[model samples]
Target: MLIFYYSKGSSALAAHILLEEAGANYEARHVALAQQEHMDPGYLAVNPKGRIPALETRDGFLSENPAILTYIAQTHPEAGMLPDTPYEAARVHAFNAYLSSTVHVAFAHFQKGARWTDDQAAIETMRAKVPVNLAEAAKLIEDHYFKGPWVMGDRYTIADPYLFLLHRWMEKAGTEFAPFEKLAAHVAAMRERSAVLRALEAHEIS
Candidate 1:
């Protein structure tokens, strides 16, 4: 049994959506970030990093979106969540890596600036730049990473959910979508999926 530790409105949504998409038998444990449950002793023992979306497998706990996502896809091969080819699969990883490393980091500047610096003014500056940075990130994805209909073109892979998470973050951050038409269309398309709707409903997200 896979016990997934996740919180609402976090990047964990990506993995949560993938779990539903793959139709995995898992227990969803909500770690209340607002209540600081993540920092609690028990939760800390489960994940020293205190991060959401940690997977409890028979082997052990797996942290981080990319690793957990890959695990889900690999374990449930019939789901075809990943491409069989090496280069194509690497492309999927590359897109997800960009989201995790670049886009998510840009949003973190606004959401968790204190993690970066102690200066209040610097934190405020970082926060102020979030909208612009996110917008640019969206443009980068549209111009380079994103392929029409899905992140990896025709077949919907694990990267789609991560891309959808980016869209959700952009929407919540009030980042204008008028510029990235393909991304806007992709988000709309993702919303139509039964698994996507299930994940959104599970998270109590609109």
Candidate 2:
């Protein structure tokens, strides 16, 4: 598998960490979003949406980070990145949904623009709404399954890497994780994991 990504962003970071944690054999190809490489015709042909973190699998190309993560988890069930129980699987999906639909989109609108004509309004809206969504997501994580040092119970599942990446973005957004002690601790613990550390190092993140 080949993951085309930009290391500077959260989605790519999530995919990178997940691949590392799953012990998947994969190659990372850096797509320089800052240089607008994503807009090139070739890259756009690979992903018409012109997004980073596109996964090239034997079956086909997977674009969104959540889809790629789910595929990886499901493909390698022995890695224990996803839950076996139906309800637990739903909960994990819920977390990913909240991240994608809420936190991720919110940040995107704030950091990037929505429509050309609505950039200012979208930025202000995101600036106001993103914090609220992030806080709610963090609280839900703490209240629901923030046990045994992960988003899910004792197991270090796929959610940890995603949440960890989001936490780093939250810090950038000037939101303090202090309000969510459990989530904050989870981020710190995930940072210490050998796989996560190695992944970051391999990506030359920090």
Candidate models: Cα lDDT each: 0.90, 0.76
lDDT of 1 by residue, 10-70 (tens): 8889899999999999999999999999999999988999888799999999998999999
What TM-score, to 2 decimals, does candidate 2 have? 0.89
Q: After superposition, how far is residue 113 of candidate 1 from its true place, in Å?
A: 0.5
For model 2, how does the per-residue alpha-carbon lDDT over 1-206 read when each residue is reduced to its tens digit?
65545545547888788888888888887788878988999888778999887888888888887888899898878888888899998888888877877778766654675543466765676676666666676777678756757777787777778788677667766667888888878877988888888878866767
Candidate number achieving the greatest lDDT relative to the actual structure: 1
Worst 10 residues of 2 by lDDT: 108-117
lDDT of 2 at 109: 53
Over 4 Å off, model 1: none
